[model samples]
Target: MRRIAPDHDQLLAIVAEVFREHGYEGASLALIGEATGLGKGSLYHFFPGGKEEMARAVIAHIDGWFEDNVFAPLRDGADPSAGIEQMLAVTDSYFRSGRRVCLIGAFALDDSRNLFAGQISNYFGRWITHLADALVRGRHRPAEAMELAEETVAAIQGALTLARAADDAGVFSRMLRRLRMRLGLPAKT
Candidate 1:
């Protein structure tokens, strides 16, 4: 049987999952090779800079996805409440209702964070900023908006950690319900 090579997007997604599961430091080239069905030579051919390059590409891909799906909606939607709702929905789907780990968050907790500090910080920073902006547009006071955005972000991250630790997706769903109530949005059906 012949093999079909994955395109760049598919390749990045596969690499991202490896990083998510094993972390940047733990995701060995051997592991990535096994996951991607690529040999050392082929992996290097695709990622000339090796594992570090592959990690960077994965992070970049994740960043691009959030920029398009989460951040853009939060920053550009004409209706602030709608934007917030969309952000929450997209976030839930992206995280698979807490079944998946946040690769960037995982990187932030590991020593590998030192290597990709800028990208990691920028990812979270932009999220909070855009979220605060949406809250402000929704008629919240500026300071309150910032504070709420920060709290909301922290809560979501904490909930994800807790959900994973407890091995219960319900933990995440409960946190999301609380968030929606705090934002004065209707609970999801």
Candidate 2:
């Protein structure tokens, strides 16, 4: 089959789905090929380091997604309510985008401790920092903000797992609302 120029973003997009569906250990070259419409050889051409490389690509891509979709708005001096809304909106987008599984959570659960470990660590670190900073800015004490950020992030990740298992969007939405209340986030008018 003739090869075409690979759209790395599109490839990473499908790769995200594969990673989501199969986890790190389960996703195979064949599955990636089928997902990206790239034959094994072409897939290698794009990701010569094999699964590790693909995962690295996915992590980098998701880091950018976090920046654009999650953290950037928080930096805009968005109030606590607005910040919570953006968080929920991004959560909804993540599920509706069909990349329901979180790469960070998946990496945390994987057996390859060193493989893709640093990137995953950095991803979570940045994510937590973003949330903590936003919370602190919104009148939460530094420690209280960090604690709330951690709990909120944990709740969201857990809700995603439940949402995926039940195939229920309402579960996640309801869970998020409850989390907002627990965090003392008032509903946005």
Candidate 3:
């Protein structure tokens, strides 16, 4: 029987999950092959640069996700609070309520970060920019918007760590609530 290859998106999703779960140094070809049901040669055929290439592909996927789910809504004049809330709700599910590691955070945990510094930096930079724009739309001045955006990102990353360490999602959930307030979103009735 002829072997059928996984498509780029499918293969990358599998590889990206491995990186997210294990970090770059820990995501070996053997593990990736097992996930993709591909042999070493087959996996190599898709990503010639190996783990470095795979990490890059994962970053690309993350960028697209944020483009659609994060930036687009903010730019389209959607209510920033609702858009942000929806995004976090999906994030709550995606990360299993802050139990799963962030792929960007995972990449930063290993030496492989050197291979994809630009992608990682762009990912975070875009987040802050879009978030700050939304804050400005919410009536914050540009300077405060930028500052609040950075603080929101820090709170999010920190909340994830605290949630994981405490083995509870409440920490993350609370941070999201606080983030909503920081945007000057009206309190929920």
Candidate 4:
């Protein structure tokens, strides 16, 4: 059967959702097809490497999301603390206020990691570096900023797991709140 070409963003959105719902090795082409509304051939037209390629696409998509929503705001100079609050708001919104798990964390364990460990490591490293830069701009010592940034990322990832396990989104919310307090960020509206 002939297949239709899919929009890049639309395809990635569907792929990300499927991966988020099911881990890499567990993500079936049938399930991905169901999500993308694309037949096998159509899916291949976008991701010639199939699931792994789809995962690469998601990593790229999330990197862009971070650049625009998280990293960009973190570096905004007018009011970095406000920038931080906005970043937190965007993050909380992206995870549906903790109702959903982090896509990066989802890939961190199991067979998914086997395929994308480097990409996942780069993703988190970029996050920590940018966050550390922001903290330094806030007048923290370089060493302390790096440490804080690492802890902040760790806390956020951990909160996602704890919230999911506890079936309470507030766990994630509190984690963000604590990070903000630690960084002396103005309360998010």
Per-model TM-score on C-alpha atoms = 0.96, 0.87, 0.89, 0.92
Worst 10 residues of 4 by lDDT: 76-85
lDDT of 1: 0.90
- The 0-to-1 C-alpha lDDT of every candidate, in the order given, reads 0.90, 0.79, 0.80, 0.85
Question: Which parts of model 3 have CA positions greater than 4 angstroms off?
Answer: 1-4
Q: Give one digit per residue, the lDDT tens place, for model 3 in 25-72.
A: 888899998888899888778878877888888889878987887777
Rank order by lDDT, top first?
Answer: 1, 4, 3, 2
The all-Cα superposition gives candidate 4 an RMSD in Å to the true structure of 2.0
Q: In angstroms, how far off is 129's CA in candidate 3?
A: 0.5
What is the TM-score ranking, best to worst? 1, 4, 3, 2
Which residue runs does candidate 4 get wrong by more than 4 Å?
Answer: 1-6
Alpha carbon lDDT at 97, candidate 4 = 81
Model 3 TM: 0.89
List model 4 lDDT by residue over 48-163, tens digit each: 99889889889889988888888878776466666667777888999888898788888886667878888889888987888888888888999999999999889988999999
Angstrom error at residue 132, model 3:
0.5
